[model samples]
Target chain A: MDFSGLINDFGPLTVSGLAQGAIIALFALGYTLVYGVLRLINFAHSEVFLMGTYACLFVWGLFGLDQNSAAPSVGLMLLYLVIGLVGAIIASGATALAVELVAYRPLRRRNAPPLAFLITAIGASLFISELTGVLTHRNQKGVPPVIQAKPLFTIGDTTVTNLQLLIIVLALVMMFLLDRFINGSRLGRGIRAVAQNPDSAALMGVNKSRVIGLVFLLGGLMAGVAAVMYNLKIGVTRYDAGFLLGIDAFAAAVLGGIGNLRGALLGGLLLGVLQAYAAGLFGSQWLHAASFVLLVVILLFRPTGLLGESLGRARA
Target chain B: MSVSEKATFRSSGGVRGWFGRQPVWVRGVVVAVALVLAFLLPYAGDIPLLGPQIVTEGIDWPSALFNMSYYVLLALGLNVVVGYAGLLDLGYVGFFAVGAYGTALLTSPDSVLYADTGWKWLMAVPVALALTMVAGLILGWPTLRLRGDYLAIVTLGFAEIIRIFATSTTTLRGDRGFASIPHPPGEWGGKPIFGVTDAVPYFWLGLVVIILVILGVRNLDRSRVGRSWLAIREDEEAAEIMGVRTIKYKLWAFAIGAFIGGLGGVLFAGEQGFINSQTFVLQFSILVLAGVVMGGSGNMAGAILGGALISYIPDRLRGISLGDTDLYEYRFALFGAVIIIIMVLRPQGLIPSRRRAMELKDREKEVAPQ
Candidate 1:
């Protein structure tokens, strides 16, 4: 509809898309890791990310920082960042564990049908979000501008912001580290074994319960990091933010190959860029619609996703 | 019979056993009495303890009952897809929206296509249902081949897409939706029977529609299609191997479910005489789902009870205060906790279908350590 607008904004759109995709990629890893092992959608995982967002804000609040505060010195900013990250990681990890213990574990113990698990997941998700909604009075909390978005570089009328660079770099570093852990570590091997065949993994003394807990913790930790980066980029967090973003993250996971780690990264970036391009072509309101359309198209053609589900498969 | 089975049979011999042993005529009489009582519910405020306790204090009793009627309609429809067919459709609201929008497009003066003169609400009903059924089929055709979770997400996406379109499109009228939509038509003694202000007629109309739906759904449940749905739900691969047409039955479930959901929407549009994108939210679908799963997924009675309760509870909470705040604010949060507890304690739901209950018990046996 607006080819010229799209062409003119292509560079800027791609840069922003990559940054947004980086955050989505991290958020998606939580979904991918859990699905690999449990084959459950973990509908409450969004709430886990939401808890981290609030926790980081709470930490920053302790330093008397608000959205309007002047940027702190680099040394103090680094300390605050470290503290906020730790707070967010712990909060998210704890929430993930709590969700599993409360909503999922009892059902698993009962050998409840798969539908029951989904219902409970939804229940847990609603409970956490609604509680947060009540606590926050359903207000959108502004993130303290801990990392201001100064233009770091310019190319073809597209100025890449420092915030964007940080988000992309941090996301890649996290993904690389996660990939290594899954591919190289002893605990990661346990996860892969369980994912491939739960019964066999149990027989081989993989400690299925511990492995599942570890997976949730790792996913929650990644979501926490993503939450921080999202704060930096988006500058605001709301109770309902997770619901929409969760869909995007989940879409990315499925598009890239749900259980596949690297696929989430690819899927996230692709989806982000596509959404950006769609917004340019059709106006911003159509961005989400475009993503959903893209998701449906991909699922119809390649149900297994672009990379195909390979989390359970042995590392080559 | 096995020892545990004998014990269960002995335990079930109280109220249910008494009911089971009743003559067919006697059972029919009891059901007839229950139906009469349900119809008389709008007048419940005249009764002693039951009246004040059940009727919502915030809104008028008839209006609350009308809301309950539509909610029940949605639950019944969703139960067909989720409870009977075992299809997790997280976007059931999409069908409901389609039906409402269809009615609006045909009948509302505000509609771009129908600005000259709008059709009657009665005339729009069938068109709306047909549109919804078609929407259901369109969504089901491509996504039904995928696994259960995949179907769930796709359906969710479908609803979101509908909401977006409703919000963004000029034709649909977006947030400034179609207004002055005609109400359902009927007149008595120089006055419109289905006029604004009084909601009792709407409640009665909803009740009539619900009864018709229940009768139809019950008959379907006893037919080959219903049996096929059961077979598909219990084990799709096994059912396919046994010569059941899985895809056809699933599509039937989706379309029928859509039809029922659409009916609710038509009635909703007729009652409010307004249409908007805000009316159909993802949470609306989820609430109906919770109703189905919480009440008893595979049981019609359970779906009805769950649906009614989901509608009734928030309305009941509307006037109640907790400290400085209204209890209605915390209703969803409390409902979420309730869902978790119910699933944990009774995953089969409160009024689970007998066959489904038996199947679950058998599964529990199989899962128990050797």
Candidate 2:
């Protein structure tokens, strides 16, 4: 109804969308990578991400950081971020590995059907989230806000939170590193080989289990980083937070093409931006609905994903 | 020899044959016994023959019967899509919601949604089915081409969208939901049948629907349509090469499944006396799926049995107390444990379908089958 206000408000919406997209994109990488290698949708990946958030919140609480307290110097904050990132990665990586071992490896060993795996995934997902709920005592835990950059820039009409900019930047840095790792490193080569043809990869002396473990660890690592960044942005974390966010990330993965790494990044950003635009045009309530509507539309026409390969070869 | 001759040979009566060899009276006796047992369950459940601690809390026959029949319909509907056609429709509840609300929209005494049109009770059946079928088509058309995880993602997205729309829309009264949906027209057996009045009518209604659905699906499974569907599920490319229109069969499966789901939705709505989005969450979809899995895929009897088990398990658990401790806190954990145990011990389900048994067994053989 008001064009001027809409125009002025669009700036904040775009920035916020970018930040949200960045976090989703970060989580999407783990999903895309695991799907690429194993062709199994890791339903527990979201829980892995949730574990990261809780790890950060726990660390923050342990440090007794408060919202009103002045942020420690940037160097100290960076050190803390590094430690938090590592802890989150280890915790999430171990959790992912444990799930795979307990729930998945046995099924695979028995040569269980894909449906069996899907069922197991669902069970593991519910168990993880419910366990988290019980462990956290069903309470929302707050993450002491990370303040790195001063709120120094104003683009057009909205005040931007410094934490938002840092999250986006941090996500980008981690993504770049991940891209390099996947596209450049020797382990990445093994991963690609396994994804291309597991039997052949094994024939060629690629350790199948090791490669699978590495993929889970890498994916878990990304989810962990995403958790810290997400906590920093949202200020609070809960066990069920992963459920909605996981669905959104899963949608993004599908939107981009389920197994394509670049697709995950693009899809996450696109979904986030789309949600922000939808909220700006309509309202916040329409956010989830709009994302799904967009997802259905995209999937119907471009089922392989935006950057996905042809359907025949995408089966891996 | 043609396929039809082979099928006939397989179905013919003899000591060597698997199908028609079983006597008709065996099935009749089984059905008769089951009917007697079901009716007699209330007497058995309420009365303790031996001692106070010797017996456990038993399911209320009326409620148990009602739930069993309701879920039987739900599971059968899902089986047509997921088990027979191999389409993982996470948005199955969308059709259910559509049917429930479709009936509610037409039959509601409360204000809103359709202000101009007068209340139409009987018309809601076909209308709900048609609306849900259309919704199924709209959903299935796009996602049919996608397989495996992609199909799952799209369907899940659709389900969430439906939920969000249901929750956010002002016309549907959002979270509060529409209450006091009018009862179905005419009383069963010359008495009021709506709104929890004597579970007998509802139980019979559900039983009749289940019979019809089971027969319909069983016949369909024997038809050319079912063959095409199975072919598609086995291998899309192979099925396509065999001249089966994969897309057409998939869409048909979806529509038929949704139509059945709509039927179940209407029956359920009539029983509840009110319907809302809360009644059709994603977890309900999972519950239906679990029933389908538990009953054994591609088996009508299995689906019904699974449905009955799933529907009754919660109520059965509700009455049990351990040393003055309740099971509410550990309900979900127990639920997860049940699924995992079933999958591990009885991978093929309580009553494995013929095809599913073969498929799973063949795989077992490949991995050193006993």
Candidate 3:
């Protein structure tokens, strides 16, 4: 209904969109990895991310950074950031592993139906999110002013902030390493083999269960990074924050082709830009709706995703 | 929920063995007794011995009945999709919302449609059902092509989209909510069909509607359509190869499910006499799904009981004190635990269908060495 906003604020919108996209792209990797190997949705993956968010915040709190505290010096900030990342990655990866062990492994061993896994996953998710809600008292916890937004430079009339550049650069670097790990490593090959054909992979001596665990671990690690980036960008976190973003990341995963890693990256960026444009066109309240609509459209047009190649599958 | 003796062939020494060996009439008596207890339950909460444990004393019996019946209806509706058809519909509440909004728009005085062209609550039910069925078709058209988790996410998105539209739109009035919705008007003898605090009539109304739906669904389940759904659920590709119209049956399942879900929504709107976007949360859908799965996914009886228990548990916990806080506050946490534990212990559910139960336990039929 409104084209003027998009026209007038195109540059700023693009910058913010790309920055947000980086976080989403990073998060979407988990869904893609898990889906590629297990063919299960891991509905509690949001809790994995949730644990990371709170873990980082708890670490920052231990460092005595409250909302009232001023931003730290560059050296001190980098130290806190590294500490938070470590806290986040550990918490998130552990939660993911626990979910796999407690919720998924038993069902997998029993050869339970897909719906059983979905239902159990939902239960575990509810349990974790509700536990967090009760602990947090359902309040929005503001992150300390860790990475203040300062314009680093202008690119083609777009004011690019240092924070945005940091997010984008960090996301890209992590993704590159992940891509290499998943593609070039032995563990990654095991994951790919299992994804392509689980029975055959097992026949070839690949450890199916181990590979599955590794997939969850990698996904969790990416989600942990995404959580920190999200905190830096949004400046707020809540018990249900992971859920809201998880939906977006899931949409991105689907948009990119669920099992394809690169597609996830592409999907995340596309979704972020689309949402920014949508916010410009409509009010921000409809942002989620816009992403969902885009997802539906993409799904309708290309059900397998933009790049339909799964990790080890022969592309059709 | 108890295992009957004859039904416990795997364990022939315990209480089940004796119960199973009893004559046919013995089982009939058990059913008869259960029926009697169920019929008497709404009144039994006032009894001295059973009052407090059975229910919180002085609580509204009819309201409790209404709540249970409503959830049962939702669970039954969801069962058609998730249990019978095996579709993971995470956004089933979207259909409920559609039904409610359709009813509200047509019947509520706050609606523009009501102001321009008013319709009574009774007249809105059919319209609501049709609208909800159409909504289901629209969602399923693209999504039914995808299987399992993909379908789950799309349906979820559909619900969120519906909510966002409701939230952002000026016509729906968002949080202000549509209120003063007219209830179904009529009288029995000289008495009104509906009255404040008299939830019995509404409960009875819901019961009647549920029975009709159950009857209809049972017939469908026995018919070719039901067979098609079963085939689809077991294996979609295999079913398709067997000449079953997979997409057609899936769409049919979706529409029928939506119709039933819509009926629940209509009843809710009529009973509540008001509706806002708040009532259509995704958790409500999950709760109903849990009920269906908890009771026994494919079994109609299990679905009904499971649905009733889901609502009944929370209401029963109300007014009961635990330390300083109310026990009801922990209802969801308990519910989550129950789901995980139940799924792990009894994946086939409380009143599992013999076929499904056998299939789940089929793991023991390992191949001998060739």
Candidate 4:
């Protein structure tokens, strides 16, 4: 079975898989964080990612960022990308907050059971996807091409796209920042405290609602960044983009031991790499089946997921 | 403890007391009213602005009734698993799919798999039901120990796996579903005796099934078995503490629910005469659940009404043509809004069960005595 060829082909596949994994990790983080506090899968998180992509697209169009620039100016392009990224982050953050406020907060306030919340999440997801489709009036929109880096960076016959490198690096940076937030910051402590025991955290003078909102905000911001990176890599956007992507991220979150932030990142990478290998070994048509099978297997053996703890447990 | 104490009715007439205590005649009137309405519906189009054509258009009362009846059957089936048993089966449609495709493959004129067998079409219904029940047992037996959303997620994966497989099979006609399965035997005495020529007989079939299901579930709920199920739903550990066989009860709930779902799928396959995987999507599962929940969870009447509401709302809205504003686009938005409203305002459902009603009223009484 050509084991050496498969082993030799691993490095390039690893990089590409890692790049896809990073995007999923970012989205998975949002899911895990929200679930950690609310014990509800934020079905709309995929739409948050979708919104971020649209926000970036809107910003790019406003700034006339497009291909066909003969001038080789990396610095200016970087600045433009930064603005677009920031614009997307802010918009997505606001959108996420709005969704929580409109769809979720009331249910939480009323102490509706988890099933109700799940239904609400599904509704919010459908609303946003349909809303996006209605507003954009475009099924597929082109993402403005980023300024290219010279494409000869080959490591063992595997050519890496400059865009792929940027996406992976940025995802890592965001993960690090997230780690610092969850582990090092005062708000992060409150988040952990609330997740551990909401009643105790409330006793400790933490505003539980505010901490949850902040989680959503931070998660939204990460989803926004992911949206930008995803768009840049895939080079297009669609309204119905979030459903499958959202399910995949949810799978990743569960795979990683849902509610564990680092676990989400790890799960995403593992899933991405696994799928890439599956695609390489078999074909792309098997991707969805492979991912679902992987999740079912993991859940069957380790119900708490690979991370061995769940926000679902932490929430109550 | 106060609410729970009040819920314990002391009247010891038992089953007879349960039924005789109610205004039995009132329920009869309600059923009679429905029948009368069914009889009158085809003639309702005679009124102006009401458009007699709406009722006479061959798709009127019978179509709506058939659709509602089919959904009621589906909802009642779903209620057994999700409501009485308290098991969240997200992939319930998988059972439905199995029943549907099972019947189709068995009875289908063109199916290569069963072409040599020459199985009777009616025989396929029972076989499909048995197969789907076995599937439920196979899937449920292993994962029944998982609680709440975990159970929901696993069942959902099972459903998706079944769906993906169903879609993948080009031989079962795959995406372009198997079509033109043999119809059930037609009319006797100018009316459908389990017939296939017109939609009206299907309506009658669906209506009869709905009544039988309602009566069956209601009976089950009142019997020793029903009490065991409710106890399990309320607290499985406690039920087990009291020597109730919780596993048997739960497996019973799941199997019975899948059995009913299989029946509904058979009817669905029979009506359409074509079967495909897309008919049993996750969305349909959600819709089934929405009906069960929006109607009172454990209430048979509520489930029936909820099914009618869910199935009819979309069809009604689909016909609205408002001068370039194609309201069909807003139909799902409206549907979502309705579900949200129902969840927030009336979580107990439209027509709650007798026990639920009494309990809820008692809770209110405890909260603020009248």
* lDDT preference between candidates 3 and 4, better one: 3
Q: Which portions of model 4 miss their true places by more than 4 Å? A: A1-12, A65-73, A135-138, A147-152, A310-316, B1-61, B118-120, B188-197, B236-245, B352-370
Span of ten consecutive residues with least summed lDDT in model 3 chain B: B1-10
TM-score of chain B taken alone, candidate 2: 0.87
Clashes of 3: 3
Tens digits of per-residue lDDT for model 4, B93-115: 88888889888888887677665
Question: Least lDDT summed over 10 consecutive residues: which range in candidate 1 chain A?
Answer: A109-118
Model 1 TM-score is 0.96
Quick one: best TM-score, which candidate?
Answer: 1
CAPRI tier of model 4? acceptable
A220-280, model 3: which lDDT tens digit per residue?
A: 9999998988888899899888888988998888888898989989989888988998898
Candidate 2 lDDT, A1-316, residue by residue in tens? 3356557778887888989999999888777888888887887788888888887766766667756556788787887787777778778788778767766677766676666666666667667777777667789876665555457588767667777788888888888897777777788788888888887788888888888888888888889888888877787889888877988898888888877877888898999988888887677888888888888777777878888832114423
Lowest summed lDDT across 10 adjacent residues in model 4 chain B is found at: B361-370
**What is the RMSD of candidate 4?**
4.7
Listed for every candidate in order, the interface RMSD values in angstroms are 1.7, 2.6, 2.9, 4.1
Show pairs that collide, candidate 4. B45-B52
Off by over 4 Å in 2: A1-6, A66-76, A134-137, A148-150, A155-160, A309-316, B1-21, B35-61, B111-121, B185-191, B195-200, B319-325, B365-370
Against the true structure, what is model 3's DockQ? Answer: 0.52
TM agreement with the true structure for every prediction: 0.96, 0.90, 0.93, 0.87
Task: Give the candidate order by descending TM-score.
Answer: 1, 3, 2, 4
Using DockQ as the measure, which candidate wins?
1
